[model samples]
Target: MTREAMAAFMFRMDGTSSYQAPKVSPFADVKPGDKFYREISWMHSQGLSTGTRQTSGKPLFQPKAALSREAMAAFMFRLEKPKAYQAPKVSVFSDMKPSDKFYREVSWMYASKLTTGYKAPNGSRSFGPKQSLTREAMAAFMYRLETTLRLK
Candidate 1:
Protein backbone atom coordinates (compact mmCIF):
# COMPACT_ATOMS: atom_id res chain seq x y z
CA MET A 1 0.00 0.00 0.00
CA THR A 2 1.09 3.59 -0.59
CA ARG A 3 2.06 5.82 2.30
CA GLU A 4 -1.08 7.92 1.78
CA ALA A 5 -3.27 4.84 1.90
CA MET A 6 -1.55 3.65 5.04
CA ALA A 7 -2.02 7.04 6.62
CA ALA A 8 -5.71 7.06 5.70
CA PHE A 9 -6.15 3.54 7.06
CA MET A 10 -4.47 4.47 10.30
CA PHE A 11 -6.67 7.54 10.61
CA ARG A 12 -9.78 5.53 10.00
CA MET A 13 -8.63 3.03 12.59
CA ASP A 14 -8.14 5.92 14.96
CA GLY A 15 -11.78 6.93 14.37
CA THR A 16 -11.15 9.91 12.13
CA SER A 17 -13.89 9.07 9.66
CA SER A 18 -13.69 12.32 7.69
CA TYR A 19 -12.04 15.68 7.98
CA GLN A 20 -11.40 18.84 6.02
CA ALA A 21 -7.94 20.15 5.42
CA PRO A 22 -6.68 22.70 7.86
CA LYS A 23 -6.39 26.33 6.71
CA VAL A 24 -2.60 26.01 6.81
CA SER A 25 -1.05 22.74 5.87
CA PRO A 26 1.90 21.36 7.81
CA PHE A 27 3.40 19.70 4.74
CA ALA A 28 4.78 21.60 1.75
CA ASP A 29 4.42 18.55 -0.48
CA VAL A 30 0.80 17.70 0.36
CA LYS A 31 -1.46 20.39 -1.01
CA PRO A 32 -5.13 20.77 -1.90
CA GLY A 33 -4.61 19.11 -5.28
CA ASP A 34 -3.25 15.87 -3.88
CA LYS A 35 -5.62 12.91 -3.75
CA PHE A 36 -4.60 11.91 -0.18
CA TYR A 37 -4.37 15.54 0.90
CA ARG A 38 -6.89 15.26 3.67
CA GLU A 39 -5.47 12.06 5.08
CA ILE A 40 -1.88 13.29 4.86
CA SER A 41 -2.85 16.60 6.42
CA TRP A 42 -4.70 14.83 9.21
CA MET A 43 -1.73 12.62 9.99
CA HIS A 44 0.67 15.54 10.08
CA SER A 45 -1.70 17.61 12.16
CA GLN A 46 -2.03 14.73 14.62
CA GLY A 47 1.81 14.49 14.80
CA LEU A 48 1.83 10.91 13.43
CA SER A 49 4.06 11.72 10.44
CA THR A 50 6.76 14.37 10.58
CA GLY A 51 7.87 13.77 6.97
CA THR A 52 11.35 12.59 6.01
CA ARG A 53 12.73 15.89 4.74
CA GLN A 54 10.96 18.53 6.74
CA THR A 55 14.06 20.49 7.68
CA SER A 56 14.72 21.24 4.03
CA GLY A 57 12.93 24.20 2.52
CA LYS A 58 10.94 21.89 0.27
CA PRO A 59 9.51 19.36 2.68
CA LEU A 60 8.06 16.25 1.07
CA PHE A 61 5.70 13.57 2.30
CA GLN A 62 6.79 11.33 -0.56
CA PRO A 63 3.47 9.52 -0.46
CA LYS A 64 4.57 7.28 -3.28
CA ALA A 65 7.85 6.44 -1.60
CA ALA A 66 8.14 2.94 -0.26
CA LEU A 67 7.49 2.75 3.45
CA SER A 68 10.52 1.54 5.35
CA ARG A 69 10.43 -0.91 8.26
CA GLU A 70 11.68 1.69 10.71
CA ALA A 71 9.22 4.25 9.41
CA MET A 72 6.35 1.80 9.80
CA ALA A 73 7.41 1.06 13.36
CA ALA A 74 7.48 4.73 14.16
CA PHE A 75 4.07 5.26 12.60
CA MET A 76 2.51 2.36 14.52
CA PHE A 77 4.15 3.43 17.73
CA ARG A 78 2.67 6.87 17.37
CA LEU A 79 -0.71 5.42 16.50
CA GLU A 80 -0.74 3.06 19.45
CA LYS A 81 0.63 5.62 21.89
CA PRO A 82 1.35 2.89 24.33
CA LYS A 83 1.74 3.90 27.91
CA ALA A 84 5.16 3.59 29.54
CA TYR A 85 6.86 1.66 26.78
CA GLN A 86 10.48 0.99 27.66
CA ALA A 87 13.17 -0.34 25.36
CA PRO A 88 15.43 -3.16 26.40
CA LYS A 89 19.03 -2.46 27.17
CA VAL A 90 20.15 -4.38 24.10
CA SER A 91 18.55 -4.56 20.66
CA VAL A 92 17.41 -7.80 19.08
CA PHE A 93 18.89 -6.99 15.65
CA SER A 94 22.57 -7.56 15.08
CA ASP A 95 22.69 -4.65 12.64
CA MET A 96 20.70 -2.27 14.83
CA LYS A 97 22.06 -1.13 18.16
CA PRO A 98 20.50 0.53 21.13
CA SER A 99 21.94 3.87 20.13
CA ASP A 100 20.17 3.79 16.76
CA LYS A 101 17.46 6.40 16.30
CA PHE A 102 14.78 3.84 15.50
CA TYR A 103 15.93 1.27 18.03
CA ARG A 104 13.20 1.94 20.53
CA GLU A 105 10.38 1.70 18.05
CA VAL A 106 11.87 -1.36 16.36
CA SER A 107 12.38 -2.94 19.75
CA TRP A 108 8.74 -2.34 20.51
CA MET A 109 7.84 -3.96 17.21
CA TYR A 110 9.69 -7.10 18.14
CA ALA A 111 8.50 -7.21 21.72
CA SER A 112 4.96 -6.70 20.56
CA LYS A 113 5.42 -9.44 17.91
CA LEU A 114 4.60 -7.02 15.10
CA THR A 115 7.76 -8.21 13.35
CA THR A 116 10.31 -10.94 13.39
CA GLY A 117 13.57 -9.79 11.86
CA TYR A 118 15.15 -11.57 8.93
CA LYS A 119 17.49 -14.30 10.04
CA ALA A 120 20.73 -14.99 8.24
CA PRO A 121 22.53 -18.29 7.73
CA ASN A 122 24.98 -17.29 10.45
CA GLY A 123 22.04 -17.22 12.88
CA SER A 124 22.03 -13.49 13.23
CA ARG A 125 18.86 -11.43 12.82
CA SER A 126 18.71 -8.17 10.94
CA PHE A 127 15.80 -5.80 11.24
CA GLY A 128 16.47 -4.26 7.80
CA PRO A 129 14.89 -1.14 9.19
CA LYS A 130 15.77 0.96 6.16
CA GLN A 131 14.40 -1.50 3.63
CA SER A 132 11.12 -0.96 1.84
CA LEU A 133 8.04 -2.61 3.41
CA THR A 134 6.16 -4.95 1.07
CA ARG A 135 2.39 -4.99 0.63
CA GLU A 136 2.11 -8.38 2.25
CA ALA A 137 4.17 -7.25 5.19
CA MET A 138 2.03 -4.15 5.55
CA ALA A 139 -1.12 -6.23 5.59
CA ALA A 140 0.33 -8.54 8.20
CA PHE A 141 1.37 -5.62 10.31
CA MET A 142 -2.11 -4.09 10.17
CA TYR A 143 -3.75 -7.42 10.85
CA ARG A 144 -1.53 -8.08 13.84
CA LEU A 145 -2.11 -4.58 15.14
CA GLU A 146 -5.87 -4.95 14.95
CA THR A 147 -5.75 -8.35 16.55
CA THR A 148 -3.53 -7.10 19.34
CA LEU A 149 -5.53 -3.97 19.99
CA ARG A 150 -8.86 -5.69 19.40
CA LEU A 151 -9.95 -2.57 17.59
CA LYS A 152 -13.39 -2.77 16.09
Candidate 2:
Protein backbone atom coordinates (compact mmCIF):
# COMPACT_ATOMS: atom_id res chain seq x y z
CA MET A 1 0.00 0.00 0.00
CA THR A 2 1.06 3.53 -0.59
CA ARG A 3 1.97 5.92 2.19
CA GLU A 4 -0.93 8.13 1.21
CA ALA A 5 -3.32 5.28 1.86
CA MET A 6 -1.99 4.66 5.33
CA ALA A 7 -2.07 8.33 6.17
CA ALA A 8 -5.73 8.43 5.29
CA PHE A 9 -6.66 6.12 8.16
CA MET A 10 -8.77 7.75 10.87
CA PHE A 11 -8.67 5.94 14.23
CA ARG A 12 -12.07 5.43 15.85
CA MET A 13 -12.98 4.75 19.46
CA ASP A 14 -15.60 2.22 20.47
CA GLY A 15 -18.70 2.53 22.65
CA THR A 16 -20.06 5.95 21.78
CA SER A 17 -18.67 5.53 18.25
CA SER A 18 -16.31 8.42 18.48
CA TYR A 19 -12.99 8.65 16.68
CA GLN A 20 -9.91 8.21 18.88
CA ALA A 21 -7.26 10.52 17.65
CA PRO A 22 -4.26 8.97 15.89
CA LYS A 23 -0.88 10.55 16.58
CA VAL A 24 1.00 9.45 13.51
CA SER A 25 0.35 9.66 9.81
CA PRO A 26 1.51 6.81 7.62
CA PHE A 27 2.37 9.23 4.89
CA ALA A 28 6.03 10.11 4.64
CA ASP A 29 5.06 13.65 3.97
CA VAL A 30 3.16 13.91 7.21
CA LYS A 31 5.96 12.76 9.51
CA PRO A 32 8.54 15.35 10.34
CA GLY A 33 11.72 14.34 12.17
CA ASP A 34 10.62 15.57 15.57
CA LYS A 35 8.41 14.43 18.43
CA PHE A 36 6.68 12.05 16.04
CA TYR A 37 9.43 9.55 16.91
CA ARG A 38 9.08 9.84 20.63
CA GLU A 39 8.78 7.02 23.12
CA ILE A 40 5.73 4.91 24.02
CA SER A 41 5.44 6.94 27.16
CA TRP A 42 4.69 9.86 24.95
CA MET A 43 2.06 7.84 23.10
CA HIS A 44 0.42 6.98 26.38
CA SER A 45 0.51 10.57 27.46
CA GLN A 46 -1.06 11.59 24.17
CA GLY A 47 -3.57 8.70 24.26
CA LEU A 48 -2.54 7.90 20.73
CA SER A 49 -1.02 4.40 21.18
CA THR A 50 0.12 1.61 23.47
CA GLY A 51 3.68 0.92 22.49
CA THR A 52 4.65 -2.65 21.69
CA ARG A 53 7.83 -4.19 20.26
CA GLN A 54 9.51 -2.34 23.11
CA THR A 55 11.75 -0.87 20.47
CA SER A 56 13.17 1.99 22.47
CA GLY A 57 12.01 4.88 24.49
CA LYS A 58 12.20 6.59 21.11
CA PRO A 59 9.99 4.32 19.05
CA LEU A 60 9.30 6.13 15.87
CA PHE A 61 5.82 6.42 14.42
CA GLN A 62 7.20 4.75 11.26
CA PRO A 63 3.77 5.09 9.69
CA LYS A 64 4.56 2.70 6.88
CA ALA A 65 5.96 0.02 9.11
CA ALA A 66 3.66 -2.72 7.79
CA LEU A 67 1.14 -3.78 10.38
CA SER A 68 1.90 -7.30 11.56
CA ARG A 69 -0.84 -9.85 12.27
CA GLU A 70 -0.45 -9.47 16.01
CA ALA A 71 0.06 -5.76 15.68
CA MET A 72 -3.18 -5.35 13.79
CA ALA A 73 -4.99 -7.48 16.32
CA ALA A 74 -3.65 -5.43 19.18
CA PHE A 75 -4.51 -2.25 17.37
CA MET A 76 -8.06 -3.37 16.79
CA PHE A 77 -8.51 -4.70 20.28
CA ARG A 78 -7.03 -1.61 21.83
CA LEU A 79 -9.64 0.58 20.17
CA GLU A 80 -12.49 -1.24 21.92
CA LYS A 81 -11.63 -1.21 25.60
CA PRO A 82 -14.18 1.36 26.70
CA LYS A 83 -15.47 -1.15 29.24
CA ALA A 84 -14.09 -4.27 30.88
CA TYR A 85 -13.55 -7.16 28.46
CA GLN A 86 -12.82 -10.79 29.20
CA ALA A 87 -10.86 -11.25 26.02
CA PRO A 88 -10.82 -14.63 24.22
CA LYS A 89 -9.34 -18.06 24.71
CA VAL A 90 -7.05 -19.21 21.96
CA SER A 91 -8.32 -22.09 19.83
CA VAL A 92 -7.73 -21.11 16.27
CA PHE A 93 -4.43 -20.90 14.43
CA SER A 94 -1.53 -23.11 15.38
CA ASP A 95 0.98 -20.80 13.84
CA MET A 96 -0.05 -18.40 16.53
CA LYS A 97 1.63 -20.06 19.46
CA PRO A 98 1.81 -18.74 22.98
CA SER A 99 4.69 -16.60 24.28
CA ASP A 100 3.81 -14.09 21.61
CA LYS A 101 3.32 -10.73 23.25
CA PHE A 102 0.21 -10.20 21.20
CA TYR A 103 -1.39 -13.50 22.24
CA ARG A 104 -4.11 -11.80 24.21
CA GLU A 105 -4.72 -9.27 21.52
CA VAL A 106 -5.04 -12.02 18.92
CA SER A 107 -7.53 -13.85 21.08
CA TRP A 108 -9.52 -10.69 21.59
CA MET A 109 -9.69 -10.13 17.84
CA TYR A 110 -10.91 -13.66 17.31
CA ALA A 111 -13.52 -13.54 20.05
CA SER A 112 -14.80 -10.22 18.77
CA LYS A 113 -14.84 -11.42 15.11
CA LEU A 114 -12.62 -8.58 14.13
CA THR A 115 -10.33 -11.00 12.35
CA THR A 116 -10.82 -14.37 10.71
CA GLY A 117 -7.18 -15.46 10.42
CA TYR A 118 -3.74 -14.18 9.85
CA LYS A 119 -2.98 -13.18 6.31
CA ALA A 120 -0.07 -14.98 4.66
CA PRO A 121 3.18 -13.13 4.35
CA ASN A 122 3.32 -13.56 0.58
CA GLY A 123 0.23 -11.63 -0.41
CA SER A 124 -1.71 -14.88 -0.19
CA ARG A 125 -3.91 -13.77 2.71
CA SER A 126 -4.39 -10.36 1.03
CA PHE A 127 -2.12 -8.23 3.21
CA GLY A 128 0.48 -9.94 5.32
CA PRO A 129 1.47 -8.65 8.73
CA LYS A 130 4.85 -7.70 7.31
CA GLN A 131 3.00 -5.57 4.85
CA SER A 132 1.16 -2.40 5.60
CA LEU A 133 -2.56 -3.00 5.98
CA THR A 134 -4.70 -1.63 3.20
CA ARG A 135 -7.33 1.00 3.82
CA GLU A 136 -9.98 -1.68 3.38
CA ALA A 137 -8.70 -4.01 6.14
CA MET A 138 -8.30 -1.15 8.55
CA ALA A 139 -11.91 -0.09 8.04
CA ALA A 140 -13.21 -3.64 8.33
CA PHE A 141 -11.31 -4.29 11.53
CA MET A 142 -12.29 -1.00 13.09
CA TYR A 143 -15.93 -1.52 12.09
CA ARG A 144 -15.94 -4.96 13.70
CA LEU A 145 -14.27 -3.64 16.82
CA GLU A 146 -16.87 -0.92 17.10
CA THR A 147 -19.64 -3.47 16.61
CA THR A 148 -18.25 -5.60 19.41
CA LEU A 149 -18.11 -2.57 21.66
CA ARG A 150 -21.75 -1.77 20.93
CA LEU A 151 -22.77 -5.32 21.74
CA LYS A 152 -21.13 -5.09 25.11
Candidate 3:
Protein backbone atom coordinates (compact mmCIF):
# COMPACT_ATOMS: atom_id res chain seq x y z
CA MET A 1 0.00 0.00 0.00
CA THR A 2 1.00 3.60 -0.41
CA ARG A 3 2.07 5.62 2.61
CA GLU A 4 -1.18 7.57 2.41
CA ALA A 5 -3.20 4.34 2.43
CA MET A 6 -1.23 3.09 5.39
CA ALA A 7 -1.80 6.32 7.23
CA ALA A 8 -5.53 6.07 6.62
CA PHE A 9 -5.60 2.44 7.71
CA MET A 10 -3.65 3.18 10.84
CA PHE A 11 -5.96 6.05 11.67
CA ARG A 12 -8.98 3.78 11.42
CA MET A 13 -7.15 1.12 13.42
CA ASP A 14 -6.79 3.73 16.12
CA GLY A 15 -10.58 3.48 16.49
CA THR A 16 -11.48 6.68 14.73
CA SER A 17 -14.86 6.02 13.20
CA SER A 18 -14.92 9.46 11.71
CA TYR A 19 -12.72 12.51 11.48
CA GLN A 20 -12.96 16.11 10.40
CA ALA A 21 -10.35 17.56 8.12
CA PRO A 22 -8.07 20.14 9.64
CA LYS A 23 -8.43 23.64 8.30
CA VAL A 24 -5.00 23.33 6.75
CA SER A 25 -2.88 20.38 5.70
CA PRO A 26 0.60 20.33 7.12
CA PHE A 27 1.85 18.40 4.09
CA ALA A 28 2.69 20.23 0.88
CA ASP A 29 1.68 17.20 -1.16
CA VAL A 30 -1.68 16.66 0.48
CA LYS A 31 -4.23 19.25 -0.39
CA PRO A 32 -7.56 19.70 1.39
CA GLY A 33 -9.33 17.93 -1.43
CA ASP A 34 -7.01 14.94 -1.57
CA LYS A 35 -8.54 11.54 -0.85
CA PHE A 36 -6.53 10.86 2.28
CA TYR A 37 -6.11 14.49 3.38
CA ARG A 38 -8.16 14.13 6.54
CA GLU A 39 -6.34 11.00 7.63
CA ILE A 40 -2.92 12.49 6.83
CA SER A 41 -3.87 15.66 8.65
CA TRP A 42 -4.97 13.64 11.64
CA MET A 43 -1.68 11.76 11.56
CA HIS A 44 0.23 15.06 11.58
CA SER A 45 -1.89 16.43 14.43
CA GLN A 46 -1.27 13.30 16.46
CA GLY A 47 2.50 13.38 15.88
CA LEU A 48 2.35 10.11 14.01
CA SER A 49 4.08 11.63 10.98
CA THR A 50 6.21 14.65 10.15
CA GLY A 51 6.24 13.84 6.44
CA THR A 52 9.03 12.15 4.47
CA ARG A 53 10.72 15.32 3.21
CA GLN A 54 10.62 19.07 3.01
CA THR A 55 10.48 21.25 -0.09
CA SER A 56 10.76 25.01 -0.02
CA GLY A 57 10.55 24.80 3.77
CA LYS A 58 7.21 22.99 3.52
CA PRO A 59 6.83 19.36 4.59
CA LEU A 60 6.03 16.83 1.86
CA PHE A 61 4.20 13.71 2.88
CA GLN A 62 5.14 11.68 -0.19
CA PRO A 63 1.72 10.17 -0.09
CA LYS A 64 2.14 8.05 -3.19
CA ALA A 65 5.35 6.35 -2.14
CA ALA A 66 5.20 2.66 -1.32
CA LEU A 67 5.29 1.88 2.39
CA SER A 68 8.51 0.30 3.51
CA ARG A 69 8.91 -2.12 6.42
CA GLU A 70 10.99 0.32 8.42
CA ALA A 71 8.55 3.14 7.82
CA MET A 72 5.74 0.84 8.96
CA ALA A 73 7.70 0.08 12.07
CA ALA A 74 8.12 3.77 12.77
CA PHE A 75 4.43 4.41 12.29
CA MET A 76 3.47 1.57 14.61
CA PHE A 77 5.98 2.71 17.21
CA ARG A 78 4.63 6.24 17.07
CA LEU A 79 1.09 4.94 17.40
CA GLU A 80 2.00 3.21 20.63
CA LYS A 81 3.88 6.25 21.93
CA PRO A 82 5.73 4.20 24.47
CA LYS A 83 7.08 6.18 27.38
CA ALA A 84 10.72 6.08 28.36
CA TYR A 85 11.40 3.63 25.57
CA GLN A 86 15.06 3.33 24.63
CA ALA A 87 16.41 1.56 21.53
CA PRO A 88 19.11 -1.01 22.04
CA LYS A 89 22.67 0.10 21.52
CA VAL A 90 23.46 -3.13 19.70
CA SER A 91 21.82 -4.00 16.41
CA VAL A 92 19.27 -6.82 16.49
CA PHE A 93 19.43 -7.67 12.80
CA SER A 94 22.37 -8.15 10.46
CA ASP A 95 21.08 -5.54 8.04
CA MET A 96 19.83 -2.93 10.47
CA LYS A 97 22.41 -0.65 12.02
CA PRO A 98 22.12 1.68 15.00
CA SER A 99 22.66 4.65 12.71
CA ASP A 100 19.73 3.79 10.44
CA LYS A 101 16.85 6.28 10.47
CA PHE A 102 14.33 3.78 11.78
CA TYR A 103 16.69 1.83 14.00
CA ARG A 104 14.87 2.77 17.14
CA GLU A 105 11.53 1.74 15.77
CA VAL A 106 12.82 -1.53 14.33
CA SER A 107 14.57 -2.32 17.62
CA TRP A 108 11.43 -1.49 19.50
CA MET A 109 9.54 -3.96 17.33
CA TYR A 110 11.99 -6.70 18.27
CA ALA A 111 12.07 -5.72 21.92
CA SER A 112 8.31 -5.70 22.07
CA LYS A 113 8.20 -9.10 20.34
CA LEU A 114 6.19 -7.62 17.52
CA THR A 115 8.59 -9.05 14.97
CA THR A 116 11.43 -11.53 14.84
CA GLY A 117 12.61 -10.62 11.34
CA TYR A 118 13.58 -13.10 8.64
CA LYS A 119 16.30 -15.65 9.18
CA ALA A 120 18.76 -16.15 6.35
CA PRO A 121 20.60 -19.26 5.19
CA ASN A 122 23.73 -17.80 6.77
CA GLY A 123 22.01 -17.96 10.17
CA SER A 124 21.73 -14.20 10.30
CA ARG A 125 18.53 -12.21 10.65
CA SER A 126 17.53 -9.29 8.48
CA PHE A 127 14.89 -6.64 9.05
CA GLY A 128 14.58 -5.77 5.36
CA PRO A 129 13.92 -2.13 6.08
CA LYS A 130 13.81 -1.05 2.46
CA GLN A 131 11.55 -3.88 1.38
CA SER A 132 7.97 -3.24 0.48
CA LEU A 133 5.74 -4.61 3.24
CA THR A 134 3.81 -7.59 1.95
CA ARG A 135 0.14 -7.93 2.77
CA GLU A 136 0.75 -10.98 4.92
CA ALA A 137 3.49 -9.18 6.82
CA MET A 138 1.27 -6.19 7.33
CA ALA A 139 -1.46 -8.43 8.73
CA ALA A 140 0.96 -10.07 11.09
CA PHE A 141 2.26 -6.74 12.25
CA MET A 142 -1.20 -5.41 12.83
CA TYR A 143 -2.19 -8.50 14.77
CA ARG A 144 0.93 -8.25 16.86
CA LEU A 145 0.41 -4.55 17.39
CA GLU A 146 -3.15 -5.10 18.54
CA THR A 147 -2.01 -7.80 20.90
CA THR A 148 0.74 -5.57 22.26
CA LEU A 149 -1.69 -2.73 22.82
CA ARG A 150 -4.16 -4.99 24.55
CA LEU A 151 -1.49 -6.21 26.92
CA LYS A 152 -0.39 -2.69 27.80
Identify the leading candidate in terms of TM-score: 3
Per-candidate Cα lDDT values, in order, are 0.82, 0.49, 0.87
- Candidate 2 lDDT by residue in tens digits, 16-35: 22333346632332343433
lDDT (Cα, tens digit) per residue for candidate 1, span 1-152:
57887877777767465677876667776778687788888888788888867555746788887788888899998888878989999788998999988799999988888888999999988999888888788888888888865553
Tens digits of lDDT, candidate 3, 1-152: 78888887887788375667777779888899998888888898889899857547768889989899999999999988889989888897999889999999999899898999999998989999999887678878888888875568
Per-candidate TM equals 0.86, 0.56, 0.91
- Against the correct fold, how does model 1 do in TM-score? 0.86
User: Candidate 2, which segments miss by more than 4 Å at Cα?
Assistant: 1-8, 12-57, 82-90, 118-132
**Residue 102, candidate 3: C-alpha displacement in angstroms:** 1.1
TM value for model 3: 0.91
